[model samples]
Target: MDRKHRGACLCNRVQFEVEGNFDSFFLCYCEHCRKDTGSAHAANLFSRSATLNWLKGRESVRTYRLDKTQHSKSFCLNCGSALPTHDEHLNLLVVPSGSLDTAVDIKPDARIFLGSKAEWVDKLDCIPGFDTLPQLER
Candidate 1:
């Protein structure tokens, strides 16, 4: 049997499903994430972009494109809650952890765009922190 993930917006107007263990858990301090989530940092659970299929209320999903970067974000239109962000280049779909309907014991594996992190924000247990996206030698 395979594990499945489920979640929805505050009003339960929009719901979705994602298959498989979270690819990675990371805190994003990018401006797009900050403004979209209205928080210091966004708790991001990365998975395949295609896996996050809306189970219902597709029209309630709103998108915000900040700046010229193609990495725009989607959220619940009614609640203004952050949904998932898709990174086309990485083939990654980053789901806002708070939206998950089930409990998650996963912690952020890393931090990205630390330079852009809010001044008042403090380190949360000091995970593998990075000022920018971690570049792996591929």
Candidate 2:
């Protein structure tokens, strides 16, 4: 039996699903990943056997590729949320972990591009953790 994972964009305009197990997971700290996610790193799940099916709003998804590099990302045009994109060259499907609405059984396999990580990223554990958004000191 194939496992199904559901996902959607922030606006809920774009909905999708992936069937089959994820093969690998990675937290990428490369420059393109940081810029693509607007964060220190991008958490992505990869699979060569899984199949992606669009439930709705497939037209809302757009892909961007860097001019001189193979770095690319797919995002919802409405809410700008990350989505999965298939790499033809690698024959792999890469999905942003945060984009999924369902619980994931696979954990990250490794953190890549450590050399490109931000200096402050190493201090993440030292910072106070919050269950939810904390009150801002205005």
Candidate 3:
């Protein structure tokens, strides 16, 4: 049986279901990915055979394709959360890992575009971590 995953936008305005297992997971640190996610890297699951179905609030989803490039992203217009996008040219479905409400069983297969990674990325492991928001000096 094919694995199924459900997800929603930050505001829960949009919901979707992905059917089939992800063929690969990747942490992309390219400049374009960083700009798209506003983060150090983008965790994405890629599958060529999987299907994406919007279960609710489909109208709230908008896709942006970068002109003169294969880069593209789909997001919720309401909450500005990343959503899955299908690349017709590549025949692949790219899903942002964080958008999935369901737990992901697979780990990232690789980290790509290390040359474009943020300067602070290498020292991230040395930073203090907090379970929740910890008290900080102002």
Q: Each model's C-alpha lDDT?
A: 0.79, 0.93, 0.96
Error of 2 at 81 (Å): 0.5
Q: Which stretches of candidate 3 lie over 4 Å from their true place?
A: none
What are the models' TM-scores? 0.76, 0.96, 0.97
Report the C-alpha lDDT of model 2 over 1-138, residue by residue, as the tens digit: 668999999999999999998989999999899988999999999999999999999999999988878788999998899999988988889999999999999789999999999999999998899999999998
Better of 2 and 3 by TM-score: 3
Cα lDDT for residue 6, candidate 2: 98
lDDT, candidate 3, 35-134, per-residue tens = 9999999999999999999999999999999899889999999889999999999999999999999998999999999999999999999999999999
For model 2 the TM-score comes to 0.96
For candidate 1, what is the TM-score?
0.76
Model 3 scores a C-alpha lDDT of 0.96
